[model samples]
Target: MILIGQYDSPFVRRVAIALRLYGFNFQHRPWSTFGDAELIAAYNPLRRVPTLVLDNGETLIESAMILDYLDELAGPEKALIAARGPQRRQCLKSCALATGLADKAVSLLYERVLRKDHPSQIWVERCEAQIGAVLDALEKERAAIASPFWFGTRIGHADVAVACALRFTGEAHAGVFDDVRHPALADHASRCEAMQVFREFVQPLIPPKG
Candidate 1:
């Protein structure tokens, strides 16, 4: 199996960290959708990073889809998410929100970094507001997470999602994350960053660009 993308991408980092946690052995190819457009397009025409090539040479695109597929591979007993229930729905919802936050962050950064013409300040303000709102919501959610993991007693997709999102935001805008604004979120992110799998696989890197 092969995982393509640099860890600089929070989306790619999430997949890598999950692969590590799941104890899956895969070859890591640090491909970028920017300079390596052709390489990424070979597996994902959308030219997105973090494309996973299964052992049989099947390619998986989209972080969410890749994660669900990987979760299924965990077998019934070791599934990352609860098999069924309202709790499961709530957990999935939180994960969605977290990933959405990360997506917005990436959009904002690209707007600032990629475009030759400056992106609209109004749009940037709107996205930043959304980021703040989501972080606040996550703070409340974290307070309710009694266990070390996000969803429940076991580590799950929800935890992976939240951790990756926070990791991205924190790295992109240093000192933006703190106990004052998001105590629970700060604590949760700190704990996750200290994990062996996370520390080894998910830290921000020297971002490879075109």
Candidate 2:
């Protein structure tokens, strides 16, 4: 298996971290969508990161689809998400919120950094509000949980997604997301980052040049 994309992206980072947790041995391409657009497009027409090349020469695009495939490969007992029922719904909700937060952060970042000549203040403001709302909701949900992870004692997809999103949000929009206001989320991110899997796959964000 080959994992293509830089870890700076929350989407890619989550997939990489999951591969590590699942004990999957694969190659890391660390390709940038900006510099390696053509190469990535060959595998993913959308030209997106977190593209996974399976051992059988099949390519998987999108973080969610890649994760679902991986979960199946790992089998039901070892899957990161619950097989079914209320737990599955809750887990998916948390992951959705985190991924949505990451999407807004990336959008906000592009609006500010990529659109230097004609940046839209309105779009930036909307993205900021969405990011804030996701953070507030996630923080409250995390605070109510007594377990170390989003789902009981074991680490799951939601935990990885939230941690990756938080890290990317902080890196892309420094000083915007206040750690003081989200103590639970702050602490949760710290714990996840401390894990060996996360530490090993970590990469710093590299904003586009102006």
Best by lDDT: 2
Tell me how candidate 1 scores on lDDT.
0.82
**For model 2, where is the 10-residue window of minimal lDDT?**
201-210
lDDT (Cα, 0-100) at 24 in candidate 2 = 95
Off by over 4 Å in 1: 203-210
**CA lDDT for candidate 2:** 0.94
How many backbone collisions does model 2 have? 0
Per-residue accuracy of model 1 over 38-104 as CA lDDT, tens digit each? 9889899999978999999999998988988888897657777777898779878998899988988
Say which candidate scores most in TM-score: 2
Cα lDDT, model 1, residue 186: 78
* Model 2 agreement with the true structure over 70-103: per-residue lDDT tens digits: 9999999999999999999999999999999999
Minimal lDDT window, size 10, model 1 = 201-210
